[model samples]
Target: MKRRQLVRGALAAGLTTPALAALSGTRQSFAQALTRPVQAEVSELEAAAERFSYGYQGQAPTEVLAELVEYFDEKIPPLLDRPQSVTARMRLCRTAGQMAGMAAIVLGDLGERTEARGWFDIAARAAAESGDQQLHAWTLARKAMVPLNYRSPREAARLAEESRQIAGTTPTAASTLAAAVAARAYALSGHTDKARDALTDADRFMERISGEQRADTWLGHCEQKHHVHLSHALTALGETRRARESQDRALALSAPTSSMTRTLLLIDAAMCVHRDGDTEQACRQAAAALTNVSAHYRTGLTHTRAMELHRAIPAEHQAEPAARALRQLLAV
Candidate 1:
């Protein structure tokens, strides 16, 4: 069937706009096409959904998550619970899992850990239902960031490890992302050997990203995002010089409107300076990053990174003017 025919059929079947599939940078594929065209519909449906999703890519996390969760609520129940053919079931599961994973990631960025965990649980179920090993691995890998970034990295290493094991040898965009996040978790946990292994794995996987993946979207990998994750991992491992290079690459590659990500990148850059014994300069840099960021895009992840930067300052330097400035700024 043509894309138009599929969209019309979906509407005839009581589904909403094609944009429903487009949200979450939604990438989907079925093991096969059902009588209902499940496999044949993923890429086209996702394209429409992107048109709907593209306008808000630069918005604040809160705004973006609201729209996605709203669409998910409207669309998921029938897709997931209603009776459907085998191929349709697999296709819907893949779609739901991708959307859920993206929601969970945004929720994590906002520091809504409990909510994010709930979404990841649903994504996990969807992945299982779809029997998509890569989706399942990606969901687990994305879940790791909730603890590592918003709470404690120590709590996240295991999830990352599981993702790596599942991603062993596959070079899908999702698997590459899992590997990158796994490297961060390992680095933060002080596991130098594991961190090295995961980082190498991420690099290896990155080289094999295929045309089937949507590297431009949040649902997939891009060279810029790869570097951003690298900066975080390298900083965690105290490889400051290497971290700086990655940070620079990420910044250069960043979209001008991507304020939230760019802001977080700036904070990561500040941490690189901290690793160099320039505690005072790092504090000033972080405070400056926070200062320039609009309140709209200064998400929980943003504050979390800045706070971690503050706490890492040596006690003796805590009384320094820049340190106090950062503390007072965050307190508000």
Candidate 2:
């Protein structure tokens, strides 16, 4: 199916949040008058492309994401800078911002830090121009993940706080996003209690977020997936026991579907087990995980997790075939 058809399907399927409700009524009216059926096809294609691009994240090859990013980068600028109709410009800008946010995430996942930062800045600018505070906040929160990954937890915390402040009273998705980012920041900064508190706040916010709550086009993933992302952040902070517990909860909430995501999680689980001094099990899981990594594109997140598992194995244990295999995988 075409990209636009896919986005329409996603919207029809209720996969998207209602955060754009405030803008939708006015934009819809304007869109109806200014845009022809032919233009609608283009819009739908743009939205669908973004949706598929985001759906494959953490699971697809880097080249796939790179291709999507290039497509958006080529397609959106002209639409935003020179819309065929004034009435449709706002809607186009909003959609462009959402696509930009997806690109940022893809770039970050692929370890293209410089390009990711640029894309995130573009997304923020597009959100501002479209007057969508929710999109702005979501993009900012997503951008904060870069710092968190780089071990700059303080910077990540500041960005998360900024996002929360800007989000104001419409705190459903934005607040949840901010809380998740803040939780990771606190954990990385060695504020365990604060981290736990932030995570609790995130969970509470998530509970209150019903299907009818506001939504951003760019933040279209399932709410349950946030817990899995948060669990990984906890693992990064060295809270092995908590990370394991959270991972179990996340897995119970949603089964792994993507090879890359499953491999990454398995590696994480191995790290937790290794940290807990279960060398035998860690080696087994790590070896199993390594077998899958070759199937997908390499990502910094996965590489780092694999490195952790590699370092966790004791020298004596390294002599085992499984452990030796993991070491060889990391070396490559």
Candidate 3:
């Protein structure tokens, strides 16, 4: 069976558009065509799902989660019967876990506590099954963020501590994730010292990341542009000064390529300005951020952040008009 043929079969079997696009390169499209198959179509689908999840991480979580759920519902079940295939099952589990984590993040951002917890549970289970310690630790850290966002920093801190312990046995990427999560948890929990320390650890971990080891899962490019993650953590900590600094650093690093990243940096810069009481500058940055946001399939979290900023600016400010326009765009 040719690759296209297999893809057609998957599509006929209910694969989503993104899932089908992910399998565009395979020699044979369906699971039956594996001459020396190392993994199953479901596994490949899972990996693609993971990659997509990472790609939309900084965007609105609701949109990303919706897409993920659609893919899982349409594409995952068909591959479950092939459980004897270790490589396939492993891939599927890992992908499923990552998606669950992404979903948890979205639900948490939207203040859907019950839904967030359920997604976290799914993520934990999937991570355990896949034996991907990094994914496991990362998901746990994300789980911690729910409470932190909800203003219960104490519980967030505890979860962050647990994540840190789990990450200790993992690789640099996982460790960085743990550190970032801990930083946010500490910042929200009012442990400024611990938050700064965790941020430092996260920075150190990023310094050690190599090009070859870079993996492209759905959370942006994990290794190379870690400054964005740091900026996000700083922003969560209410250290707008540090967040702006980090955002500047990320922009400098991202320049000359990747419009998506640059737009995100602009948004972060805008948020920093907003926090600093410079409504004008903040509105300008938000307007610039919308240039990119308008062009892409924004996730729910990004939209919410934009909305929060929109609500924060005073009507008397000169930039209110622009801010209002941006908010209107986001609403669409």
Best-fitting candidate, measured by TM-score? 1
Q: What TM-score would every model get versus the actual structure?
A: 0.83, 0.76, 0.66
Model 1 residue runs over 4 Å out of place are 1-56
lDDT of 3 by residue, 200-301 (tens): 888777677655334654343364356776776687667788787778777776534354556656777787787877777777777767665544434344
Choose 1 or 2, whichever is better by lDDT.
1
Candidate 1 lDDT score at position 330: 86
- lDDT, candidates in the order shown: 0.79, 0.70, 0.68
Give stretches of model 3 more than 4 Å off: 1-39, 50-67, 81-91, 102-116, 146-155, 169-171, 211-213, 219-225, 235-242, 252-264, 274-277, 287-292, 295-299, 306-332
Which scores greater on TM-score, model 2 or model 3? 2
Off by over 4 Å in 2: 1-42, 57-59, 83-87, 212-218, 236-242, 252-256, 311-324
Superposition error at 313 for model 1 (Å) = 0.8
Residue by residue across 233-292, what tens digits does model 2's lDDT show?
Answer: 678677787777766765665445555556666777887787787887787887777665
